[model samples]
Structures are given as C-alpha cells and as structure tokens.
Target: MKKILLFALILNSTFFYAQELRLLRGAITENLIVNDTVNETYSLYLPTSFSVDRAWPLAFVMDLEGKGKAAVAMLMNAAEQEGYVLASSNNISDSLSISQNVLIANRMFNSVFNTVPTAKNRTYTIGFGGGAMFASILPTFINEIKGVISIGASIGNLEILNAKQPFQFVGIVNRSDFNFRSMYDTKQVLNKLKFPNQLLVFDADRNLPEIETVSKAFRMLTLTSMAKGYLVQNDSLIRSSYNDFFVDANANVTNQKPLLATYQMSDMEKIFYPLMKLDSLKESQKTLKRSTSFRQANRSQNSYFLKESFTKEDYSYYLEEDIISYNYANLGWWNYQMQELNKLDRSAILFEKQMSSRLRGYINALISDNIDYLAADREPDLEALNLLYMIKTITDPNEYTSYLKVISTSSKMEDYGTALFYLEELLKNGYTDTQTLYSIEHTALFRIMPEFNEVVEKYLKGARYDVIEQ
Candidate 1:
C-alpha cells in the first residue's frame, strides 16, 4: 500500500509540473498572467498536447459580457481538436469606451505574444456580436494579426481595410442574428476587394456559434495558411477537409436545400481551388446552380431582400417619430409586430423564417441605437429615455440596465409602487448588487422603504437598509 501510494503521488506531481510549465490543455485555466504590472489577467487554453519546443497558432477570443473563462470554454473543444491556443481577457467589456477596450485588447495581445511561442502569420482574434465588431477592427490596428473570426456581427470601419493589407475573414452567423444582412453585405465588399473570406451560416437564433462551427473556422485558417505557403500542405489534411465539406454539402442537397447546397459547393471551390483539384466541386456547383430548386431559392432570397429593405426603412421612420413624440401607445403595436414575426419564424418556408427573424432583430437593433442616441444628447430626453428602457425590458429582460433606469426614474417621481415593482422585477432578473441597487441616483427615498427592503432581502439574502415602522 505504501509503495502504491508513493507511485501515485509521484505521478500527480509530475503532471502538475508539466501543466505549470505552460498552460494546460483540455481545461480552461483562469486568470493567467498577461500583464503583472497592470494586474491584468486572461483565461487560456493550450491544447493538452502543447509543448514549448514548437510555435503554435493562437486565437484571442473575446466576449462582450467579459466572461473570459466562458469565452475560452466555448472555443476550447475546437481549439484542442485543431491544435490552437485560446486566450480571452477578463477585463475587456462592451460598456467601456472604444479606447479603453482597445487598450485592454492591446495589453492581452502583447502579453500573449511575449509569453506564448505563437506561429508567425497565424495569430487570429475572435469575438461575438459587438465583440465581433471589436475583433474585426483589430486587424486594422495590428498588422501582425493574420485574420478575424467574427461571429454575429460585420466589419467595422471598412475605410481601414485596403488591398495592401487584406486578411482572412471567417464569419459565423445565424439566420436570425440581427447582423446577417450586414455580414452578407460585407462579404460582397470583401469579394470586390479580393480579400480571402468565408461566411458560415447556421439555422439558429443565438449569438455564439457551435463548437464544430468554430473548429471548421480554425481548419479554414489552417488551410488558408497552407495556401499562402506559410505552412506546409499535408495531403491527408487536404483530402479529409474536402471530403467533410463535400459530405455536408451533399447532405444539404439530399435534404432538398438547393440554395444551401449550391453555396457549399461554391464555397468549397473557393477554399480548395488553390490547395487541390476542383473538377468535382465545379461539376457539383454547376449542377446545383442550374437546378429548379436553386432558381426558386434565388428568387426567394431576392424577394426577402427587397421586403427587408422596405421594412427597415419603415422601422427607422417609426422609431424616429415614436422617440421624438414619446409615444407610449406604440408599445401595443410593437407587441403585435413581435407576434407576427414569431409566426413567420415558425413558417414552413426557410426564406420567410429568415426574413421575419431579420425584421425582429432589426427592431431590437433599432431600439438599442435609439437608446444610445437619446442617452448621448447634451440635454437628455428623459421621457424618450424612459420609454426606450421600458421597451428594452420587454425586448431583453435579462439586460439589467433598463430595469435599473426604470426603478431610478420611478423613485425620483415619488411613485413608490412603480419603483418597488421595477425593483422586484430587477431582482427577479438575477441582479444581486445590493450596493448598486441602493446607490442609484434619485433612488434614496425608495431605498429606505420597507417594501424595498423585503424585496431586496428576498433575492439578495441580506437587506442593507433598516425597515422603519410606519
């Protein structure tokens, strides 16, 4: 027993030392030092097979919510399988000013570069939603970055991009994501500039992409590197990738999706033309494109685009008028529209579902934009601000800011009932910042109320305020 115990202890110590030398693979290692001077930290995932002997590819993943570990986890399965290092900063947030966010990203980038033996010409950045926008903007500022994997959002500041500095772009978006149209438009511009880019589409309504989707993106990056002669081409890898994509595209055709099938066929040709022969892909693309289903799909797409243009214009016009007039009555109409859109989401036709999802996403985007505009004015429009926040609670109940605003404004107006109502609603949404709840400007009066204390204590486990007897 003593001998066995000694052997186990030795094995455990060896494993620990191995991981301590460089970040461990397969599990997320949180708060790895990026900059000790700034006390900055980022989560890291080095594939379990990581070694300091050779340089490895790197991906800096960002989540606008600032959950570095969560972001790293999302990419860990993909990164491990694809042999890439993944890092995400704990400090970067969407609410920060552009400069602050840039600084945070720069610090992480420099730290990772200084610590990790990253392959030359293989560094990439990835982000979702606004974070995707942030990642898209990084290649412009940092010439060392070779590509961007932007999810759920399109490029930002296109003036910064030129043929002299083109980079690979891999966009993973969903049918219902608000930025689908923007991503489609950006693809057109990228093609015009002759930049290497690919768009991966999924049929979902969420922001973050699937792990297999991310893995495919990493594979695309690797293939692009090999095509550029930065990495040696492995015939086995080339064959495997082609087969995988071909099988998937053929499956689409089997399911009677000629549009998706044709896109996959065309994308495969673009991706593999430089790496291998494209005779098979060319034939498949030609056949799919000429099919009746393909023609119908094209027509459906064209009609959807036309309808979306008109709907977007109408939404913009109504939003402007509604905000200016502080039209609370329009809430019912918006609710009706949401239901109609939901019906379309359940439609049997894929195109109509895509259209309705786009419209709903557009409305939410418009609301967020208007809120920003209203909040940024020198003389803020309180009525408009209040109206928008309320709408936000309906649109995105998990976003706590709108509830906070409502509670603050209601308290200021001495409407204790309304204030208490929103406060409870905020708590129910999982808000636990007792200090922030008590410290919101114009909320001092309501903070001392017994009703407020009860609600706070119910959710937060401890009430900071004393309840005075009436």
Candidate 2:
C-alpha cells in the first residue's frame, strides 16, 4: 500500500512539472489546459519579472463574453507593468447560467492556484461588462479574493456582502454608462459598511477602459495592499500617487466639474486614509465644498437625478408592458422615444445629454437581456424573440442583424405582413448585403413571394429571384 501511494504521488508531481515547463513568462499563453479529467482551459500571462522563487499577486479575470484570450490581452499590459499574474477562464460565458459559469471559474481558479505560487491575501478578480458584475460578487464567495476591479458594471448584489469578510472594490466606469449612478450609490453603501472602495470615471464612448486607466487600477490594488500591510510599502509610489490624485482634483475644479472633483477628493480620502494623515486633504475638501461652484453643481445634479429616475421607471414599465403584450402597434412609440433621445443629444445641457445617452444604452441592454432570458430556456420562445428583434431593429436601426432575425422568425410564424414590412424597412435602412438577405432561415417560400424580391430589387440593382415583372 505504501509503495502504491508513493507511485501515485510521483506520477502527479511529474504531470505538474510537465505542465509548468510549458507555461511562458513575459507573454500570453493562450491554451493552458487545467487538467486532463476536466479539460478546463484558460489564458495566462506572467510579467517578465516573474520568478518561481517568490509568490506573486494573481488576478483571475472573468470574460463574460467567454473570449478568455481577449480579456487577458486587455489587461496584459497592466499586469506586466504591475508585476501581477493573470488567468482568465475561456469557459466563462454570457449564455451560461450564473452558477454554471461560477463553477467553471472555480475550476480554473483551483488549477491556477495549484500551478502558480500566489501571494497570500493579495488575490483579485477583474473584468468588464457582464464579467465586471461577476467579479464584484466573487470575493464574497472566494474569501481569498482581496479585491475586485470592475469596469462598466455596478456591483451585482449588495445583499450578499458580509462586512466581516470585507474586500476592496475598485470600479472604473464611463461617465455616460447607465450604471454610473448605481455605482455612485454603491460607494456610499460601501462607506457605511466600512468597505474600502474607489470609483474612477472617464468621459468617452469606448466600452473598454484605456490602458492607462487599467494600469492605474493595478496601481491602486498594489497601493491598497501596502496600506493594509499585506505587502511592503514603497514610499515613492505612495507620494507619486497622492500627487496625481491632487492634480486630478484640481483639474476637475478648474474645468468647472465640481461633482467629478468631489468624487475624486472622496476617493483620495478613502484610499489614503490608512496610509497617512489626511488633515490637509480634508481641509481642501471642505474649502472645495464651500465654493459656489460646488453648491450649484450639486443642485443641478440633484435635479437631473429626478429626471433620470423618472425616465428610467418609464422605460422599465413601458418595456415590460410591450414585451408582455407583444404590443406590435406600440412599435411607433418606441421609435418616437428613440427620436426624443436623439433630441437630447442636441440639447445644450451637458447633464441632459448624458442622461439621454444613458437611457438609450439602458434600454438596449434591457431588451438584449430579456432576449437572452427567453433564449436560455430549453426551447426558446419564438414569439418573445420575434418581439425583441422587432424592437431592436427600431432601437438600433443600423445593427442590421436583428432585421434578419425578425424576418426569419416572422416568416416561420407565417406572419407575412410583419415580415414584408421589416424587409422593406431593412432596405430603407440601406442594408445592402444581398447575400445574407438571400439565405435567411425559414424564408424559402417567404423569399420567393413577389413582395420580398420587389423590396430587394428596389434597394439593390438586382435580386436573386428577379421575379418582379419589368
């Protein structure tokens, strides 16, 4: 029995050693299989400075869209510069149930933990979009996770958080993201719960944060570790970061962005509270609050908050009603709402413009999520899919694919009238891909109808059918 156990141990060691040899440092390794039995795979990156001699801080990156390599690449530069290890599970998918994806994440975590020498109490989870929501709640389940860097998503569920098992939360969000207000509120809750947190905002239409912001997030994590005595402090880093925050706050004030300036000052207070004396910073904050610009900006923000809240509720209620009743006739109203949102874009008021963008994005996300929910069933509900596709075509007219889906689903139900209407609407939008138009599923008979070819021939120079009489 002893000899058999010894042999088994030897075999395991050899297998792990073989796996270790293949992992490369200084670059991304795309296909690292976790184990033979489970076959869980992930993309991994180690900083050029990495060595087996020292335990390294590791980040488990979640890609809600399930492209692990892309997620790894997004943060690879930051990880390399910050000297942290990164591993993202290729199986973390948006289509899968939350619990199922979490299980897949756990498998990848264990695999990386077993293979890599990780720093004790310095682990983190980071992601963008759906992955960001997943990352925010991960520390609650995986007690070892010390921090989370969530971009473009607010915390998923605040009820599950335990104050005793506190972890740092660093959120990076766009000023125009609908989740902006939610994250701001979350920061207040975190403050009351005595959880360490910071929120970084950027103004842009981009989905992913710039590389510099990502690097700052990594720096913040490292700085937090030092503050907590989890890692050794570098005084130079602390001094430089403090100065940068000060510079940013002053910049915001100069730009007449009192709200952003206050938020920046608040972040500085929380992040540096444990590391140093904040008396001077507090005095500066007080003076900033006393300024006329601050009071006016605060009042303006409060007024806009009401408008945003009312608008969001209306969207939620109307969208639910439309989806529940398959209110085809109300499609005009949805189109009208889009037009109103566009008018907000032209409004001279910046806050109104931001609210408009947020509402538009929120509605699209709502529709897509509802569509995903319906599609997740064992058998998808075609009626619901049909309604969502139609709504999507109106909300996001240029996407073009939703038009195809609407055509396919409508034709399948033999709702020739609805299908023909969208066929023309799609052409009106200038969707010139005749090849894709020709191969729409469940359209064998529908496409041959004179109406379909007529719409196509009218848009394009010629139609495949050429059935319209000269």
Candidate 3:
C-alpha cells in the first residue's frame, strides 16, 4: 500500500509540475486537460499577485455546454480584482446525468485542491442558466463548497437545503430573466432557513451580469464569512462595505426606484446585522416601504405576480401533458397564446406589459425544462426535443439556439423542406453565425443543395457555393 501510495503521489506531482509550467498568472489558460480518459479539461485564471505561500480563494464555474474559457472570461476580471482563483471544467455538461456531472466536478475540485493552496472557507461555485442550477446543488452534497453565485437560474432541489450546512448564495439575474421568479422565491426560502443569501436584480436579458456586480457578490461572500466568525473581521472593511450598500439604496430612493431601494435596505439589514448595528439601514427600509410610490408599486407588482403565477401554472401543466403525449394539434393554440402575449407586450398599461413579459419568460423556461428532461433520457425522445425547440422559437423568437436545433434535426431526418424554411427563418431572426450553420449535424447534404446556395447568396453578399447534383 505504501508503494502504491508513493507512486500515486509521484504521478500527482508530475502532473502538477507540467500544469505549473503552463499556468500563467493574470490571464485565462484555456482547455487545461485534467483526465485524459474522458478528455476531461478545464480553464483556469489566477491573479497576478498569486503566491504559493498563502491560501487563495477559489471559484469553480460551470458553463452547461462546457465552454470553460468563455465562462472563465466572464468572471476573470472580477476574480482578478478580488484576488480569487477561477476555474471552469470543459467536460461538465447539462446533457449528462446530474450524478455523472457531479462526479466530474468532484474530480476537478480534488485536482484543484491538490494543485493549489485553496482557502477552504472561501471556496465557491458559480454558473449561468442551467449551469447555475447545477452550482446551487453543489453545496448540498459537496460540503467543501461554502457559497454559490448563481446567474440567471435558481436552486433545483429545495428539499435538500439543510440548516446544518447553510451556504451563502448570491443570485444575479435580470428583471426579465426567465428564472427571476424562481430566484426570488429561493431567496425567500433561504431567508426562512436563516441562510446567508442575496439576490441581485438587474434589467436585461439572460446574460452575464456586469463585472462590478460580480465583484460585489465576491465581496458579499467574504463579508458573510467574516460575520460568521470564520474569518477575522476588519472593522474598517465592514464599515466601508456597509456604507457602500447604504448609499446605493439611498441613491435608488432618490432615483425614483423606491421598491428597489426598499429591497436593497432589507437585504443589507439581514446580511449585516450579525456584523454591526445598522440604525440607518433599518430606517431606510421603513421609509421606502411607507412611501406612497413604493406602496403603489408593490400593489401593482403583487397583481402582476398573481396573474403571472396563474398563467405559468396553467401553461406548465398543459405543456408537460402535451410534451408527454406528442400532441401536435395543440400547436395552433400555443401559437395563438404567443400572439396574445405579443399584444400584451405592446399594451399601454405598465402592469400588463410586466405580466406579459413574465408569462413569456415562464413559458420559455417550461419548454427549456421539458427539452432538458427529454434530452437527459438514456434513449432521448428526439421528436419531443424537436417539438420543444419549435415551441421555443414561437415563444422566444430572438433566441437563435432553437432555430439552429430545428434546422439541424429536420435536416438529419431528410426533411429538406422543413430545414429550408427554418434556415430562412433563422436568417430572418438575424442569426449571422454562418460557420455554425454549415457545421451542424447532417447539414452537409442540405447545405450543398441548390436551394440553400441560393438563399445563402441572397442573404450573404459575395457568398457562393457549388451545388452538387446527385
């Protein structure tokens, strides 16, 4: 056993020696292969100020499709500014079983732990969209993870949340993001469980939050640790951070954003109470909540929430039933509902517009969930996945992913006519990734046809291709 352990130690040392030679400081190193058997790889970014003498904070990022470098890039600036080591796995994927993916993640975690001096109390995992859901699940099973920064998604298994192992959660999502409601509810649940958590709301689509927002989240996690006595508290740092949040909340009040101001103050009070006294924070929350504008906005949002929830539940139920049964006849009804939502989006009333947006977000999320479920099966239902993609386009036309799916799947089935139609629709939707179009599965034969060449030429000037006549 000692001989075997000696050999293992030598292997690990040799592996990391090679890594140390390539792991440059202050920039992202893309596709650092970890396990050769499955081609398991990860991207890593280390702060320029890194040293082997002291433990460093680390963040594990998940990118669903295994775009490790892309995900690393999104958080690299924040990680550098905050002096945290960032790593993302290129092999972890949404299509893989959760257990399988988690095992891969565990390997990556063990590898990183062995390679670097990681601060155990500061280890965090961050992910976006489906990847965010994966990140949220880590703390429940992986006790080493202390926090999660979930962007554009929420916790998957609420039943797994345990007070015994409470983890810090910082959710950054846009107001119009499909997962906003779920994230909001998650914050409430976390609060009930007395967990350290904050949900930052921005105003945009499903995308990475600003670098500043990411930095703030990192700082908040640090504060949580300090407040919990896991780290030595710096009074100056505590005061400075508290003042920044308080000022931001006051600024929101001045900017005619009473609701936002109120929530900000509320979060501050909850997060900072254990660290220091906050008379001003408490007062600010009361003032904003009592303000007429805040009251009115709150009432309007309540009404929108109720209506949106009803629509979401109804659609979720019907969508699941339809997907399970492959009910194509209901496509027309879904289309009609989409048209109605379009009208509501254009409505004069603000509440109507908000409700419509939430409803649209809800449906898109449901379809995505259904597609993911069907795709995860050992023998996936391609027909059902295709149908969900089609529905995704109708509900969220601006999303180019669904169009690409429809085109690829139709071409694979030799349904040239359907492929051609979606190809044009994809172009009309402003999808300019021509290289991606040509590289899709089973598209070689379809792209070489006369009709495709004609369309490509019309849309992309100076584009020409020889059509093969078989």
Candidate 4:
C-alpha cells in the first residue's frame, strides 16, 4: 500500500512536470537609457517537429499578470500539438498607458524573436481584457505581426488600422457589458474602414466556458482558414491538441464550429459568426428596400400627412421587429430611430406616443417590488423615482405614498441629496395630500433643509395654506 501511494505521488509529479511551463525573464527599456526596469517574463511551447532551421508561425499572447504565461502555455501546447510554435508573455504594467504597454509589448516581442530567430516575421498576438488592448495596439509598432485576436478590449482608432495590412483581426466581447456600446461603435468604425475584421459579441451573462470555447474555436478556424488559403491541410496531428488546448478551455464546442460554417465559415468557427453575417445581409436588403420604397412613396404622395404616416409606420415596424428578434432590453436604438424620423418631419409624434406604454411597462418591470433586483438593474435615480411615482398611481397609490415617506426619512438619516428629487416626483405624480407633504417637510427641516433653509422657506411660502398648516 505504501509502495502504491509512493508510485501515485511520483506519477502526479511526472504529469505536472510534463505540463509545467517554461518562463524566460528579461527587461525592457522605454528610453535609450534603459532607466526603468520592466520585468519581462514569457513562456514558449514548441511543436513535436520543432526545428531550429525551420520557421513556424507564432502566436504571442499577452496576459494581465502572471496568468499570461499559463494562458499562453495552454494555447502554445494546443498549437504545438497542431504543429505550430506559440509563445506568450506577461510583461505589461498595470498603469495601462498606451506608451508603457506598447513599449513592454515591443520588448517582449524582441526578446522572444531574438531567442528564437525563426519567429521574426511569423507572429500573431492575442490577449484578453487589458492584454487585448496590448495586442490591438502592438501591431502598429510590430510590422511583422500577421494577425490579432482580442477579447474584451477597445479598438477605438479605426483610421490607424491599415485596411490592406492583411492582418485578420477578430474580437470577442460580451453583449451585456457596459463597454458594449463602445464595442459596437468601434465595430462601426472598423466596418467603415473595410478592414479584414470580425467581432463576436457574446451574451455577457453566459459562463466563461461558453466564451472560451467560442474563442478557441474561433482561433482554430482563423488559423485553419489561413492554413487552407496557404494550402496546408493535413490537420490530423493538430486534432490531438484540440482537447489539450480547447477542451474545457470553454464549454459546448461541439456544435459551435459547424454552426459558424453554415453561414460561410468554411472552418471551425462560432455559430454567432454566421448569424451575424446573415443578419447583416438581411439588414442591407431591408435598408435598400426601405430607401427605394420611401422614394417611390414620396413621389406618389400629394399630402405631407400620408407620407409622414407611412414613413413612421415603416420605421416602427422595422424597430419593433429588430427589438423582438434581438431581445434587446434597451430602447436606445428605437429612440434613435424615432428621433431621426422626427427630424425628417414634425408629424412623427405617433412613434413617440406608441413607445410610451412599452417603455413605461419596461421601467415598471425593472423596478418591481424587488429592491435588490431594482438596484442591480441600476436604473437611473431620476428614472427610478419617476417609475416609483407611476407605480404609486397605477398599481398601489397607498404603497407608493408610504414608500416615498420612508425614502424621505431614510434620505434625512443618510443625508442623501436625491430625496428632494423623489419628493418632487411624488408631488408631480399627485401624492400631494397635505399630511404626506407636511411629513416630508418636517423630516427635511431636521436634516437636509438646514443646509438649504432659504430655499425650503421660499418653497413653503408658495405652498397652499392647507399644506402649510399640516
């Protein structure tokens, strides 16, 4: 039994050693003087047939800190298993300045390329989060960079990206992220540039495994597609690394690749990839049809009322369909469309009126009795107050009045400035019984009103005699 235990320990150690990453330490200099010592660390994994004489395409992964080496190692092992040499580094500073990050990235690239002479021009960089920012920016300096795969980074400057650079860029972002709007804006800019790029916006609430699997498959597809273009198709040996590199690298990889290909992805890719392509195609077709129809309708219509009504109806249907199909919770796009339609003509008030009920319903659902959930939703304070008032009038007036009184008292205790905002909302929404208003005024005097007594006194003077008596 002791011998078996000893053997088991030995076996575990052997397995660990076999998979252990190799780290190389170096330093980078921002200036010619080499004044600041940035500790540069990287890990390398070579394929089974790795040769000093033969050059291999490389992937340089930048990570946030120590984890960069491990992530790179995993990717490297996976790539190497597929007959590719991959290297990774974690030499970035937490400061996140573009200059500092770019310098560190250049230094890491130089260090790795210097050690492995064949890696000079065959490098692709990939990063997650801050690391993604590094990868996105590194190509500007490193002319040899072939491609980039960024996860959760802002690619804000589209003009800087050379459209003809042949650097296939891909980004993975969470749809529910606060940065998603920025991401979409970035994508719009990139799309205008006509650069070879792809953006995979995943559902933010999904697990990391779902994200990682999609990312891994995307990386493989991108690599394989490039490989196919280069006519290198013997990927049998590469299949072995798929499990080591991508298995549990995320979740549900099985059906994802096939789904991506159904929409023009000829290799292992994400299902969303094809869906986006199809969506884009449909949008383009709809836009053309709408423009043509609008022109034709405008030419035939004698009255402004008919033309305006027709346009608003068409836009309303389009936006409603988009919302239902995408399950978009926010009315930002609808608002924007309505605003544009309003600009085109003054008579498009119907769209705005139609959206009021839907918008109010959405706000109420968001603020529904669950305070924790309401807080989690992070509804704007003013909006919350407005909804609370609406809830008071529409659902339970007594409860709403009680809630406002409690809020007013809590605000006095906490010295919250927004109590007045809520109070104003309550007043506007007809929670204006003399007793309730007096209770609010009395609480304010002890805490908040003291700081602004003059304003409160002026407000009280304007109040009705009944309210003042209360």
Tens-digit per-residue lDDT, 1-470, candidate 1: 11111111122222133234334546777887764489778888878777656789999997778899998887788888999999999998878877788888888988777666789999999988888888888887788899999988889778789788888999988867768888989989999999888998777556667888889989999998999998899999999999998998898888877766775676677789999999878887888888888898889888988988898897788778888888978877666766777799789988898888788778777888888887889988877888888777766678898899988877777877877887888888899898898899898878887888989988997898776666
Whose TM-score is greatest here?
A: 2
lDDT of 3 by residue, 297-348 (tens): 8898788888788888889888887788878688787889999998997887
lDDT of 2 by residue, 97-139 (tens): 8889888988898878877788999999998887989998888
Backbone clashes in model 3, listed as residue pairs: none
Question: Model 1 lDDT vs. the true structure?
Answer: 0.82
- What residue pairs are clashing in model 4? 82-238, 209-251
Error of 3 at 83 (Å): 2.0
Prediction RMSDs, each to the true structure? 6.5, 4.4, 5.4, 15.9
Q: Give the C-alpha miss distance for residue 362 in model 1, angstroms.
A: 1.8
Model 3 poorest 10 in a row by lDDT: 1-10
Error of 3 at 248 (Å): 1.5
In angstroms, the error of model 3 at 141 is 2.2
Candidate 1: regions farther than 4 A off: 1-22, 205-207, 376-379, 393-404, 414-470
> If scored against the real structure, what TM-score would every candidate get?
0.84, 0.91, 0.81, 0.42
lDDT of 4 by residue, 1-470 (tens): 11111111122222111223222212111111111266466566555555445456667777757355566654543464445455665556554677876776677666556444343345777777667766776777778786677766666355577666646567665533434435556756766675556665443333122434444534554444445354244455345333334333223224232212221221123322321233543443344335544344334422433444465455446534533453233335544643553354343432233233223333333335333333455443434333333333333333565346544544645644545544554445544354555555336553334333332344444342322222
Query: Which of the numbered candidates is closest to the native, going by highest lDDT?
Result: 2
